[model samples]
Target: MFDIQEIRSQFSILDREVNGKPLVYLDNAATSQKPNSVLDVCHAYYTELNANVHRGIHTLSQLATEEMELSRRKIQKFINAEHDFEVIFTKGTTEGLNLISYILTQKLQKDDEIIISYLEHHSNIVPWQLLCERTGAKLRVIPIDENGILQLDYFDQFLSEKTKVVSVNQVSNALGIVNPIEEIIAKTRKNTDAYVVIDGAQSAPHFNIDVQKMDCDFFVFSGHKMYAPMGTGILYGKREILEALPPFHGGGEMIATCSFDGTTYAGLPFKYEAGTPNVGGNIALGAAVDFMNRVGHENIQNHENALLEYAQRHLLEIEGLKVYGEKAKRTGVVSFNLEGVGISSDVGMILDKMGIAVRTGHHCTQPIMEFFNIAGTVRASFAVYNTFEEIDLLVEGVKKAQRMLS
Candidate 1:
């Protein structure tokens, strides 16, 4: 049986108090709270197996290597990648997208087009902008509607022979609206031979990911957003596509054999992984995956959906409160602003005094903020452990803020 209290118990931070009140954590979209399993695994790895991976012939090194590779396999199965070699460890989603953009500089020429949507985080936008600046390529964007949903009709118009890449997020980090990635992939495949990249940083935590079913050339997500430690992430690509691209960084492990004359790169995953990796964090990521598997995605989705609906309904009932993306299908995020509240930071500060932790500002999504003709929105994003009672506190806190500020 899916027990909310049992699930909440696994996260020790949920029990803590802030400002003399219990911490009502709703800033999950920025980063999720770590469970006991994940924290324990990280601690165990450092205490028991503290050695550099893929280097020495010692037992500690061997064990460390095994644990890291085992984590890779877990991620491969998690995303349903065709091969384990396709999963490359990255610093996070930003680094993963930047890696793709940097490597594709070789393929992208002058006048070549890269397509991204307005819903993208700065990580998805700035890299492509830099790529275009370097290669003299053109950048095209798919528009969004008033409801903050992607204007799918305009996506077809952007597809053409010159289009070399179509990179988009599976879910909007700021608005929490799920994009039609499968449809986007289908359209890209039918119209052009462009490479499709799905940034799963927001979606990976809430839904089951199947790279094979999505049929995208590349997919990337941050482990920290999905209950793992910081500095751990995954970048999965088609074997053929990954093999064709050159190494992103030149360092010790990524080389086949170093020589004064010339050098050769290593195989699939190692080719991308340079220098020392976060062995403990990767192992902890595996534990995080195991934890999610134990909880089951269906239960997580159902619980979070309830939280989203209930929060939205109650938050909207407040006078002078406006919810962004209210009509769109979203995960567990609610973005809103009060009528008289000129700045989002003011509201966030007031909520902080009430022990409600919510994110404020553009959320690294300036394009989305621009579209709404506002400076920013107060975003309250949920997770598996968040409760309806906490959400009630959030609503009441916002009401208090409104009364105090407005």
Candidate 2:
């Protein structure tokens, strides 16, 4: 059995009341509530080891460097990367995706193709589009099925010699759909020499990620969504591919030596991490990895799956209510809207009044909304501390709203 109360105590902010009522923070997909251990690790970094990393001869500076390098090793084991240098600390998923686009476009010639999917967040889509515009390379999109799953039939037809890269979300952020990435990569690789990039932002937190088994060329995920501090992300690329790729930016740590004639770039992690990186945030991510290990992801996955099933059934039972991505055994997330609500934000606001928080709007997947013929869906995402009683409360709240409006 999952200990809801035990997990609740781990998050300090979860204890606070919202709108004079006990807070039911269903807005976890936006960002998760961090545990005290994660917070304390971040705090300890500033208090004990505050210094710029990699360039200091002082005691504190050496300690800071130790912490950052150790953090990299932790991330290596966290995602089970083949090599430690393959893990690059980024600002977040947005930066990681942008780095891929920047690196690929620098190498690809005109007419080269990088395929993405409609299920991707705007962060994944816009950067590649920008890169395509710069390089005169075309951006191809793999269409999705009616249920928000990626259409593999269309995917096979799209992959060819022209395809140089394939970037996809492992889990749809807006739809709560787990993509068939392993199969997609297998077939896509069979057809041509395209690099496979998996956005594990949603999947990393909920499930155990074994990139070796997946064989994705690149993997990206944000730290904040994984119970770590914001301002940190992980980019795990195959070592040879990463070494062959050009650096995304030029600056302080990323240079071997500066000269008016020419400049040589730094090696590996330093090459990708241009300037002063988030030392404290990177250390906190290590703590998050430790936290997840302590509380087994199997337990986390089972708990959340139960919540998703219960919430999906309850949401559909209500009049004129529809739950999108009604995939059984999905990660504990539901995207839906009430009938005749007209605007999801209105419903979201009302739910907030009752101390039930939810996310509203296109959820950074405007293309997905366009494909579904919906402006947006009200999203209620779950975490470990979330309960069946909370789902019951949400059902009651929605029923109250429906009746009041009727």
TM-score of each: 0.99, 0.97
Model 1 steric clash pairs: none
In TM-score terms, candidate 2 sits at: 0.97
Poorest 10 consecutive residues by lDDT, candidate 2: 324-333
Model 2, span 1-406: residue lDDT tens: 5688998899988788888878888988888889999999999999998999999899999998998889899889989998899999998898999999888876677898988998899998998889888988888898876777777788888888988889998888887788888888998889989889999899999999999999999999999998999998999999989889898888899999889999998878788999889999998999998898888999888898899989988889987998876752257579998888778888787788888998999999999899878899999998877889999988887787777664
Tens digits of lDDT, candidate 1, 1-406: 8999999999999899999899999999999999999999999999999999999999999999999999999999999999999999999999999999999999899999999999999999999999999999999999999999999888888899999999999999999998989999999999999989999999999999999999999999999998999999999999999999999999989999989999999998999999999999999999999999999989999999999999999999998999998889899799999998999999999999999999999999998899889999999999999999999999999999999998
Predicted structure with the largest TM-score when compared to the true one: 1
Backbone clashes for every candidate come to: 0, 0
Off-target runs (Cα >4 Å) in candidate 2 are 327-329
Error of 1 at 293 (Å): 0.2
Q: How far off is residue 231 in model 2, in Å?
A: 0.8
**Off by more than 4 A, model 1:** none
